[model samples]
Target: MSPRQRDRVRSLVADSEAPIDAQTVAAELSVHVTTARFHLNNLVEEGSAIAINLPPIGVGRPRVGYRLVVAPPVDDLMLMLVARLGETPEQREELAAEVGRAWAAKHLPSVAIDAELVPDPVVLAETILTRLGFRITDVVSAFGQHEITLCGCPLEKIEHELPEVARGVVRGLLETALTAGSPALAAQYAVAVRPAPGGKCELRLNLAQVADSTAR
Candidate 1:
């Protein structure tokens, strides 16, 4: 595969939540297994993905799978959205808010704002979502409120069983997220942990209207 094709394959793998094999890649990309293997080996050699060995229950040898270890670029998505909105400040703001709302819908459990504490909740919301492994797909702002759309899971594991190291990682991430355009905006930031359906965990932040937003 060419470099561009390899990059596209990598993006697909990152977007997928589970490990995949060469055959699966071939089918997904409409390429032959040989071609898929070529790119997979190249990615492994470059350390972009790791080869995982899974043993079958019947005492057979392990099968190989590939897992992505890197993330796709946010700038690419942002640039596309910018182009779509045209070259106007109002359009840009609208896009930014749209992005925010979309992000909150997919990634956050729920969001509400302590308007008395922060001037711009959308920016704060985006920061938190980014920290949580959700990429900002789009953004817009209206009447002082910002909206964002997001995808991906920075914290995919169950929260109750989260290790200390994981909690530390999230805490550090939250610290970064809490920092917005100004100290006042930062002070208003807070994330609430709640139980998600199907026994999963979700994050609720102190930003408004996130639940109503949907991911793109």
Candidate 2:
């Protein structure tokens, strides 16, 4: 998993006061339900979080959720790792790019690209993110790039606490979507995801001219 994915999982699990379910965490984290479940289970085994059964409303089996159990100390290994990475901003950014490229290589095969340019890649991108609970307010094209406006942070308001990792996840999401959704334009390009007004996030896809390039 990428740093963003891992950190967001830990953040959601750590910050919550009550037990949180996989579906809810998935939406807030902008990750698949399965991804959230996978990481949550791991955290449970690590003793960082604990799993509990939610009282059923009117069902045979109760629902399961995770609650934060402990906090990583200031000198914790993960904190130290993040600090070390922060020491080299350029390398950290490159690693973030690779996280996106690697994710694209994994999921793009299933996205069904076409021979011709597809109608706004943003549409498809929105669908994927929406399923993970990252609500899309609007999407538009201008200045030769697709702009997507999103509401809700999958990290559950912990984005500023770990901005690089949070942005890294968005970076991967946009890059992968653009590459898979528009193979014809899968050439080298960059994207930016920023916090927006009214508690939203903005994605600006800098779709540039195609050039020979390798995946990050």
Candidate 3:
């Protein structure tokens, strides 16, 4: 972030209500909303802002809002360095995935142990990811395969070099679902990831494979 750009972003809402939208910022700054969105998006990527969508009372689309976040970027460089410190690509991926699983286990409610019933954990994954800042673009399900597209990755770093991070998140979500859901059925499930353009990606879990695994 450049000095002038940083000043422009910070000067917009030094003393305003939180969770403001780009439109509000543009209106106040007397600039186009797109321009405001650009700066706000930069702010979000820089960890100076948080983006959220508030569901409206009516039937229209939810309103997207931004909340200012004030914190030092202490972990920025450390995360980058640590993320690269792995013996091999496979080790790095596993390490990243482990981090994600740990995060989920620590943050999410404990799954019922030896309980009467275990529900589908996949359903819970969507909700958790949303709260963690991944927006669902669409869900496609057919022929016993389920696929979902998320608009943005929670990690701010570029997706190409650090796909392990995104993959780890998906793995974490699924592992938690499996632990919370049916272990037997979970053993039959598998996850496949495909990177998309613009910080987006697709996750697939195909139940069709369950039949094949059963045959084996």
Candidate 4:
């Protein structure tokens, strides 16, 4: 279907530990079962997630569920920091950059991975986040804009590390997705990262003028 829909499915599948049936996904997203199924099929086809068929219970037909198959572990620090970024848009980039620097300064001290081996900044950030267990929940596109939301990752541990490079990576990913024309509109873009009550982090994009102003 739409890019936004695919993003949403990615988010949902990433968040789930086990296979999730269409009914559950529909309920969480407030969409019709058929709509959920359509998106799930798309995700499966894209190789972003996997679909599992359940054994029949007794009465009717068996149900199917989808789960994220290619995601990495969830990082507690990244989750918390991303969530906090949502509260203030005026300084999101600055804040994200600062967070990234802080992370490098602190955690990088003991990390032994070669710099060259690290994926490109954006992919590395996404990989670290997925490893930290963040899930994609929604990809919204309206009025010529694109935005994505992620949930199910703890944000408390790494709030201090979010700054500079980390923020840049997040912003870059949003730009990349938008440049790819994930959204049908041609407008300014904004990315919001926040955490929910259940240790779930929400990353959203706003295509409204507010987004345009912030981008400038």
What overall lDDT, based on C-alpha atoms, would model 4 receive against the true structure? 0.54
RMSD of each: 17.3, 16.1, 16.2, 20.0
Candidate 1 Cα misplacement greater than 4 A, ranges:
55-61, 70-216
- Judging by TM-score against the true structure, name the best candidate: 3
Tell me the tens digit of each residue's lDDT in model 3 across 119-203: 5444655765676677777777776566666654555453445666666666666565555556654655666555654434444
- Quick one: RMSD of model 1? 17.3
lDDT of 4 at 159: 33
- Candidate 4 lDDT, tens digit per residue, 8-113? 7678878887888888888888889998898898778878778888866688888898887765546754565465775654466566655544443332223344
lDDT string, candidate 2, 61-125, tens digits: 78789987766575356545654555565566566557656755565437556767554666656
Return the TM-score for candidate 3, rounded to 2 decimals: 0.53
Backbone clashes under 3 angstroms, per model: 26, 2, 0, 30
Q: Write the residue-wise lDDT of candidate 1 on 65-103 in tens digits.
A: 788776667756644544455365445434434444444
The C-alpha lDDT values of all candidates are 0.53, 0.66, 0.63, 0.54
- Which scores greater on TM-score, model 2 or model 4? 2
